[model samples]
Target: MQTMKLTIAGKGEGDDAPLVEDLIGQLGDFLGLLREVEDAVAEPGEENEIVWRVTGATRNSPLSIEITAFPKRHGMNIDQRERKVRAAAAHGLAEIKRAPARPDWFDDRALTKAGGIFGRVSNGLAATTIDFGNDLPPVVITSETARAAAANIVRIQKPVDRPYRELGSVEGYFEGFERDGFGRLVLRLRARLTNETAKCILQGQAAAAFEERSVGEVIERGRRLVVSGTLHHRGPGRLYQVDADRLQLLRNSGLPDVADITDPGFTGGLRSEDFLAGMRDAGSA
Candidate 1:
């Protein structure tokens, strides 16, 4: 068991939640670059701070590391403090046999001393989905890098080998259809892949590849659809995606057919539970 004590740089002035969150994320990235961590847990601490507990397995036994942050402390210098923590963690992990070798993309100085480090941290954290309904976002490191980088050696530095071309098709019920912020229509399908319901996205040119059917009719849930497209593996992790150009709606066969109506179900009822609850609470008040 190794314990590293590092004072969190920003805490307890005005609104420093964002700063604290960014630092925690950067620390996670640093740790991932150091060793092969198995599990990590984070919990709340006093003084508006957070406690990070990291655990990893070694050839001989399991090793654990705990990093505590004091958010209320003043004079928090991230560039210096981050480098110190990274050095300490690297040295500690080197004692273990199962520790992962440092990657080429890992530039401790570049990651720590770079300008707009906090901004990069913010974008990194936002790329992930967090369950903040129970409490604040858990400061846990599931993967090394937040955004897929071609240069990141610790996690996804090398590009995945690609075949000449891969063709794939899916016949499933239309789960949802929505336009993204950039006016790109995204279609989600619930199809059976490996005996489990796999949710796939049909976006970009594939979303409009079918001129016979409009995107409007495909929004209805339970509409079976057969979408065929070229598959390409991308990102540092090489996630597979389909560039669909052919989409057909099949009857009773669990495939999507063509869109007959130009504007299907354009007028739908808008119900608000908050308005109804307010009306009921008025009588009691």
Candidate 2:
């Protein structure tokens, strides 16, 4: 088991409720995909490097969160428990909402150091979808740098093998992506590969390891580079691919909501009874 500790350096608002709720939710995630919890967001000091800790086991792939925030202002104080969990959710337990249209989504928008670090290192999260027309925009499946949606992020070099292993990666076309009724990222990716492009255009719909995984191969092109790809989706670790011919990015709408996949009781100001009641109301109303 690896004990992850972080010293969150920045201007903290020092709020504990959000922090605590975020933490409990993360711990539940560590326990299992099906585990559910409510309210873990924390409130630490405003503008201080808070020391955070999370005890996790490799077997369960989970951990407990802890933090100590120092007030940036004199006499400023915080609930230590709150500080810890907030740091965890913002940093560790929580997943980055990769708004690709924004360059800083991966860097600047990370709520905390732990979130950014984990987003960079954790496995899965190769690709997230963008729905241009469909109600479901797209959710970021993975954000790990090691395992990117497309193996070669930026297509720079010519192929050295029979079929190009990877083609150029596309991102940053919009200021921000939108989400629709189904909670999916709504966007489309179009690329003109240089001459004979990579044989495969790998796709990662979101961060679940190998979830929605596939490769697209370019067969024809004009003076403009040829483009080809596929839509991949996974369930229960099983693989499925949508045929490129019928697969249209335009069918989807906005982005996926973390709340949908996250534990219903998971915190975000949505209380247990209220959350359930809201869902019920949403269904009927």
The CA lDDT of each predicted structure is 0.39, 0.28
* lDDT minimum window of 10 residues, candidate 2: 34-43
Candidate 2 lDDT by residue in tens digits, 202-239: 23423111123222211111111112344342221111
Candidate 1, superposed: residue stretches over 4 Å from native: 1-165, 195-216, 233-240, 253-285
Identify the candidate with maximal lDDT: 1
Global lDDT of model 1: 0.39
**How would you encode candidate 1's per-residue C-alpha lDDT over 213-251 as one tens digit per residue?**
655666566666676776554442232444566676655
Model 1, clash count? 10
lDDT of 1 at 272: 61
Per-candidate TM-scores read: 0.26, 0.19
